[model samples]
Target: MDRPEKLLTTAQAAEHLGISRGTLARYARDGLLKPTLKLPTGHLRWSLEDLRRQMRELREQGGE
Candidate 1:
């Protein structure tokens, strides 16, 4: 069976993506990356799978 997806807070997601929190927020604003969840307190969360997929796509497109 497949494992459940891991959820990451904005800071953790940014760190995993090798980017700053501000940049991650910009990407979300630009629709480059969508948050998996937004808590009632207004915090963003991202799925590890989604981040990994984006990284793979970026690599395929010759982006760092």
Candidate 2:
């Protein structure tokens, strides 16, 4: 299978970071997480690298 190059949906990104969708949504709202693409269906998409960066930041902050 071919790997996707970029952009993950909220669910995928959350799963990768081992977080709930609600938490991801809140991060997005707080501007801690930014979307690379906003689909017509109102779904937010984030780059894999960006998601990983956010996860790293969260880990550093130790809020969980």
| TM-scores of all candidate predictions against the true structure | 0.72, 0.70
Position 28, candidate 2: lDDT: 84
Structural RMSD, model 2: 3.2
Give the residue spans of candidate 1 off by over 4 A: 1-3, 58-64
lDDT of 1: 0.83
Number of clashing residue pairs in every model? Answer: 0, 0
Q: State the weakest 10-residue window (summed lDDT) of model 1.
A: 55-64
Which tens-of-lDDT digit does each residue in 1-64 have in candidate 1? Answer: 9988889998999998788999888877777777899889989999978877876786798865
Q: Encode model 2's per-residue lDDT on 1-64: one tens digit a residue.
A: 9987777888888898788988888988887777788889988998879778767787798844
- Alpha-carbon local distance difference test for all models: 0.83, 0.81
TM-score of predicted structure 2:
0.70
Highest lDDT: give the candidate number. 1
| TM-score for candidate 1, residues paired by index | 0.72
